[model samples]
Target: MSRRGWTLFLAMSLIWGLPYLLIKVAVADLAPVVVVFGRCAVGAALLLPWTVATGQLRPALRRWRPLLAFTVLEMTGPWLLLAYAEQSLSSSLTGLLVAAVPFVAALAARLTGDEDRLTRVRVAGMLLGLAGIVALLGLDIEGAQLLPLAAVALTVVGYATAPLVISHRLPDVSGVAASSIALFVTAVVYAPFALPRLDRLDDASGTAVLSVVVLGLVCTALALALFFALIREVGPQRALVITFLNPAVAVLLGVALLDEPFTLGLAIGLPVILLGCLLATWRSRPRGAMPVPAIDAAA
Candidate 1:
C-alpha cells in the first residue's frame, strides 16, 4: 500500500471503530430507535444529495430489492441491535463480539457460493473463533446479559451476510449510492418509532446529543466515503483488513474514555478471535492464476 492507502486505512480503522463508543454514549439518554434513526437520517441527508448529483441515485434505486435487503441487514437491523445491546453490554465487549464478523462472513461466503470451498484452515479458524466467544461468555458471564448478547449475535450475522448480498446481487451498484439509499430507507422505516421519542432529546445530555451527531456525520457518512476511497487505493481485499484493527481501536477508546474495564475475557478472547479471523479469511493464490483485479466496492 502507498502512503495515501495507509492514511485511508488508518482513518477507516478509527472511523469505523468509533460507532460502538458513540452509540454507547448516545443510548445513555436516547431510545435505541432514536439513535438509529438519527444516524441513518443524518447520513442519508449528507450522502443522498451527492449520489443524485453524481447520477448514481437512479442506478441504485433501480436495484431497490437487493438494495433494501442490503440496508436491512447492514444498517436497519444491526444498528438497532447494537444500540439496544450497548444499553447493557460495554462498548469494549460489543466491539470485541463484532470482531467475529469476519469468521461469520467466511462461512456466509461459502454458503452463498461466493467462495468455492470451505478449507480446513477456515474450518479450524471458525472453531477457534467459536472458542473465543465461549471464553468471553464463560469468563464474563456475569457482565454479559443473555438477551443483549443474543442481539449482538444477530447483529454479527447481519453484518457478515450483508456484504455477500452486495458481492453477488448488487455487484455493479455504486457503493456510495447504495449506502445513501439504504440510510434513507432505514430512517424512513424507523421514523414512526423514533419520532414519538424526539421530545426525549430535550432532556438528553450534551455528550449524548453530540455522540448522535458524530455517529451520523463522521462514523456513517464520512467513513463510507473514505472506505470507498480506501478500496480504490488498496483494493477491496486489503481494504477489508481494517476489520482486524477496528476492534482494537474500539477497545482502546472504550477503556480510555468510557472507563470500560479491560476484563480477563477481553484480554484472552481478543487475540484469539483476531487470529481466527486472519486465518479464516486468508486465500492462497493458485500457482499460475492471473492476479485478481480490484473487486469493486459493491462487494
Candidate 2:
C-alpha cells in the first residue's frame, strides 16, 4: 500500500472500531431507539453537503425503492439491533460478535448463489463461528437475559442479510449516496420514537452527547470516506485487513473504558470467531479495490 493508502486504512479502522466504545457511551441513558435515531439523523445531516455538492440528489431520489430498501435492510434494521444488543453487551464484545459478519455473508452467498461454491473449509469456518458465539453467550439459562441475547442474535442476522441486499438490489448506487440515504431513512423512521425524550435528553451527561456526535460524524462519516479511499489506493483485499483488527480494538476499549467483565467466553470465543472469519473471507481469486461494506455484509 502507498503511504496515503496506509493512512486511509488505519483511519478507517479506527473510525469503524471506535464506534463500539462510543455507542456504549451514547446509550448510557438514552434508549436504543434514541441512540440509533440520533446517530442516523446526525449522519444524514453531515452527509448532505456531498450529495448536494456532487449533484447526486436528483438521480438518487429517482431510485427511491431500492434506495429505501437499502435503508431498511442495511441502515435501520441492523442499527437498531446493534443498539439493543449493546444494552447487555459492551462495545468491544459487540465488535467481536460483528466479526462474524463475513462468515454470515459467505453462508448467505452460498444460499443465493452469489458465490455458490462453498468448500469444506468454509463450512468448518461457519461452524467454528457458531461455536464461538454459543460459547461467548453461554448456554446457562440462569445467567442470561433472553431478550438481550436475542437482540444480539438479531443483530447477527441483520449483519448477514445486509450483504445480500447490496449485492443483489443496490449494486450500482454510489456508496456515499447509499450510506447517506440509508441514514436519512433511519432518522425518519426512528424520529417519532425518539422525539418525546428530547427534553428529557438534556439532563444526560455531556460525555454521552459528545460520544454520539463523534460516532455519527467521525466513526461513520469520516470512516466511510477513508474506506473508499483505501480501497482505491491499496485495493479491497489489503484494505479489508482492517476488519480483522476491529474486534481486538473493541476488546481493548471494553476493558479500558467500560471496565466490562473479561470472561472465559470472550477469551476463547473471540479467537475462534476471528480465525473462522479469516478463513471464510480469504480468497485466492484476483481482485479490484472495492469497499468492505460492513452494512451490506450483515447478511
Candidate 3:
C-alpha cells in the first residue's frame, strides 16, 4: 500500500467506525426511519450532483434493476436495522457484529461462483469467527437483545450481499453514480415513515441533531465516496481491513465518549474475530501457478 492507501485506510476506519456511535446518538431523539432518511437525503444531495458532473448519472440510472437491488440490500435495509439495533445494543457491540461482514462476503463469493476456491484456512477462519460470534452472543442473545442481535445478523447479510451485486451485476456502473442513486432510492423509500416523525425533532437535543447531520454529510456521503476510492486504490479485499479497525475505534469512542461498557465478551471475542477475518480473506499461493501480485480482492 502507498501513503495514500494508508491514509485512506485510516480515514475510512474512522469514517465507517464513527457511524455506530452517531446512530446511537441520533436514535436517542429521532426515529430509526428519520435517521435513515436524513442520511440518504444528505448523501444524495451531495453525491448526485457529482455523479451528473462526472457524466456517470445516465449510465448508472440505466441499470436501474440491479442498482435498486444494490441500494435496498446495501443501504436501505442495513441502515434502518443498524439504527434500530443501536437503540438497544451498545455502539461497541454493533460495530463488532458488523465485523462479520468479510466472512459473510467470503461465503457469498463462494456461493455465487465468484470464487471457485474456499481454502482450508478460510473455512477455519469462518468457523473461528463464528465461535467468536457465539461467544459474544452468549452474553446477550436472550430476551430484549434477541431482536437487535437478529437485526445485526440480517444487516451483515445485506452488507455482504450488496458488494457481490456490484461485482457480479453492475461492474460497469460508476461508483459515484451507484451510490447517488442508492441514496436517492433509500430517501424516497423512507420518506413516508420519516415525515410523520419530523415533528419529533422539535424536542431533540442539539447533540442528537448534530449527530444525524454528521451521519448524513460525513458518514453517508463522504464515507461512501472515500470507500469507493479506497476499493479502487487498494482493491476491495484489502479495503476490507477497515472492517477490522473500525470496531476498535467504535469501542474506544463508545467507552470514552459514551461510557458504554467494555464487556468481557467483547474483550474475548473481538481479537478472535479479527484473526478469523484475516485468515478467511487470506489468499494462498499455489505452488504450480504463476505469481499473481496482490491486487484488490475480488468483489
Candidate 4:
C-alpha cells in the first residue's frame, strides 16, 4: 500500500473499531433504542446535506425497496440488537462475536450462488469459526448471557445479509447516499421509541452523552466516508483487513479502558475466529476474478 492508502487504512480501522466501546458506554445509561436513534440521527444530519449537494442522494433513493431493506438489515435491527446485547454482554465479547460475520457471509454467498464454489479453505474456515463460537458459548454462556448471545447471533446474520442486499439489489447506488439514507430511515423509524426517552438524559453522565456523539459523528458518518474512499483506493478485499483488525482493537480498548474481563474464552476464541474470517473470505484467484464490490459492517 501507498502512504495515502496506509493512512486511510489505519484511520478506518480505528474509526470502525471504536464503536463497540462507545456503544457499551452509551448504553450504560441510555436505552439501546436511544443509542441507535442518536447515532443514526447524528450521522444522517451530518451526511445528508453533502449527499444532496453532490447529487447522489436522489439517484440512490430511486430504488426504495432495496434501500429500505438494506437500511433495516444493516442499521435498524443490528444496531439496536448490538446495543441491547451490550447491556448484558461485555464490549470485548460483543466485538469478538461480530467477527462471525464473514463466516455467515461466506455461507450466504455460496448458497445464493454469488460465488462458484466454497473453496476447501473456506470450508475449513467455517468449521473453525463454528468451533470458536461454540467455545465462546461453552465458556461464558451460563445464566443471562444466553439471551444476549442469541441477539448477537441475529446481529451477525443481519450484518452478513446487508452486504448481499447491496451487491445483488442495490449495486449501482452511491455509497454516500446509501449510507446517509439508511441512517436517516433508521433514525426516523426509531423516533417513537427514542423520543419518549429524550427527557431522561438528566441522570446520564457526560461520558455516556459524549460516547453517543462520538458514535454518531465519528464512528458512523466520518467512518463511512473514510470507508468509501478506502474501498476506492484499496479495493474491497484489501479494505477488509480492517475487519480483521477491528475485533482486536475492540478487545484491547475494552480491557485497557473499561477494565472488562479478558477471559480464557476470549483468549482462545478471538484468534480462532479471526483466522476463520480470513480464510472464509480469502480469494485464491487473481484480483480480476473478485466479485462485485459490497459494503460491510463498516458502513
Candidate 5:
C-alpha cells in the first residue's frame, strides 16, 4: 500500500473502531433505538445531499428492495443490537466478539455463491475464531446474560450478511448512495420509537450527546466516505484488512478511556481471532481463473 492508502487504512481503523466506544457512551443515557436513530439520521443528513448532488440518489432509490434489505441487515439490526448488548457487555468484549464477522462472512460468501469453495485453511480459521469467542465468553464475562450474547451473535451474522447483499445483489449501485439511502431508511423506521424518547435527551449528559453526534458524523458518514476512498486506493480486499485492526483499537480505547478490564480472555482471544480472520479471508486464484471480486467488509 502507498502512503495515501496507509493513511486511509489507519483512519478507517480508528474511525470504525470508535463506534463500539461511542455506542457504549451514548447508551449510558439514551435508549438503544434513540442512539441508532440519531446516528443514522445524522449520517443520512450528510450523505443524502451528496448522493443527490452526484445524481446517484435516483439510481439507488430505484433499487430500494435491495437497499432496504441492506439497511435491515447492516444498520437497522446490528447497530441496535450492539447498543443494547453494550448495556451488559464491555465494549472491549463486544468489539472482540464482532471480530468473528470475517469467519461468518467466509461461510456467507460460499452460501451466497459469491466465492469459491471454502478451503481447509478457511474451515480451520472458522473453528479457531469460534474458540476465541468461547474463550472470551468463558474467561472474561462471569455468568453473561444469554440475551445480550445472543444479540451480539446475531449482530455478527447481520454484519457478515450485509456485505454479501451489496456484493451480490446491489453490485452496480453507488456505495455512497446505497449507504445514504440505507441510513435514511433506518432513521425513518426508528423515528416513531426514537421521537417519543426525545424528552429523554434533555436529561442526557453532554458526553452522551457528543458520542451520538460523533457516531453519526464521524463514524457512520465520514468513515463510509473514507472507506470508499480506501477501497479505490488499495482495493476492497486490502481495505477489508481494517476489520482485523478495528477491534484492537476498540479494546485499547475501552481500556484506556473507559477503564474497562484488560482481562485474560481479551489478551488471549484478540490475537487468535485476528489470526483466524486473516487466514479465513485469504484468497488464492487458480491459473487462468478469473479474479474474485472483493466484497465490501467495512463495518
Candidate 6:
C-alpha cells in the first residue's frame, strides 16, 4: 500500500474506534437514541451537499427500499444498539466485540459467492481469532444476565451485513454517498424519539457536542471515504484488515482518556483480536482496488 492508503486506514481505525469512548462520554448527558440520531444528522449534514453536487441523490432516493434496509441494518439498528450497549458495557469491550467483523465478513462473503479460496491459513486464523475473542469475553457469558455478549453478537451481525449491502445493493454508490444516506436514513428512523429531546442536547457539555460532531464528520463520513478508497485499491477482502487497528485505538483511548479497565484478561485478548484481524485480511491483496491508507483504524 502507498503512504496515503496507510495514512487513511490508520486514521479511520482511530476515528471509528474513538466512537465507543465518545459514546461513553455522550451517554453521561444525552440518551443513546438522541446521540445516535445526532450522529446521523451531523454526518448527513456534512455529506448532503456533495451527494447533491455529484448527482447521485436522485438515484439513491429511487433505491429507497434497499437503501432503507441498508440503513436499518448498517446504521440504525446496530449503531443505536451499540450506543445502548455502551450504557452498560465498556468501550474496550465494545471494541473487542466488534473485532469479529472480519470473521463475520469472511463467512458472509463465502456464503455470498465471493469466490475467495478458504485456505487453511484463513481458516486457522479465523478460528484462532474466535478463540482469542472468546478469551477476551472475560465476563461470564452465562452470568452477565443482560447478555452484553449477545448484544455484541447482534452488533457483529450489523458489521457483517454492512459490506454485503455495499457490494450488492449499492455497488454503484460511492462510499461517501452510501454512508451519508445511511446517516440521513438514521436521522429519519430515529426522529420520532430524537426530535422530542432536541432541547435536551442543550444541556450537554461542549465536549459532548464536539465528540458527537467529530464522530459524525470525521469518523463515519471521512472513515467511510477512506474505507472505500482502500477497497478500491486492495479490494474489500484485504482492505478489511484495518478492523483490527480500530479496536486497538478504542482500547487505548479507553485506558488513556476514559480510564477504562485494562485487566490481565484484556491484555491477553487484545493481541488475539489483532491477530485475528491480520489473519482474516492477510491474503486479501489482489491489487485491483486503490491502495489503502493505514493511518488510523477507527473504521
Each model's TM-score? Answer: 0.80, 0.74, 0.81, 0.80, 0.81, 0.81
lDDT tens digits by residue: candidate 5, 1-299 = 56876788779878998998889889999999999999999999989988899888888788889889888988899999999999999876787678677667766766667534567775676667566655544537676799999999999888777766666577667778888888998999999999999998889999999999999999999887676566555543345556666776676676788798988977887677667655654545544675534433432
TM-score (C-alpha, index-matched) for candidate 4? 0.80
Better of 4 and 6 by TM-score: 6
Off by over 4 Å in 2: 1-12, 116-142, 225-244, 254-278, 286-299
Clashes (candidate 6): 30
- Every model: Cα RMSD to truth: 4.0, 5.5, 4.2, 4.3, 3.9, 4.5
Candidates 1 and 3, the one with greater TM-score: 3
lDDT of each: 0.76, 0.65, 0.77, 0.76, 0.77, 0.71
- Which TM-score value belongs to model 2? 0.74
Q: Pull out the clashing pairs in model 2.
A: 92-250, 159-298, 159-299, 160-298, 160-299, 161-298, 161-299, 162-296, 162-299, 163-296
Positional deviation of residue 145's Cα in model 3 after best superposition, in angstroms: 4.2
Candidate 2, residue 110: lDDT:
65
lDDT of residue 97 for candidate 4: 73
TM-score of predicted structure 3: 0.81
Clash number for candidate 5: 0
lDDT tens per residue, model 2, 1-299: 44665566556655777877777877887788888888888888877667778877777778788777756755688778888878777664566556566566555666776533456665676667557655655544444467766766666666566545655565545667767777887898899999898886878889888887887887766665455455445433334445545665566566677797888877887687667555543444435553443332211
- Number of the candidate with higher lDDT, 1 or 5: 5
- lDDT score for candidate 1 against the true structure: 0.76
Residue pairs with clashing backbones, model 4: none
| Worst 10-residue lDDT window, candidate 5 | 290-299
Q: Which stretches of candidate 5 lie over 4 Å from their true place?
A: 1-9, 116-138, 227-241, 254-283, 291-299
Q: Model 6 over residues 44-135: C-alpha lDDT tens digits?
A: 99887788898878877877777778787778888888888887777756776676777777788888887555667666766666666556
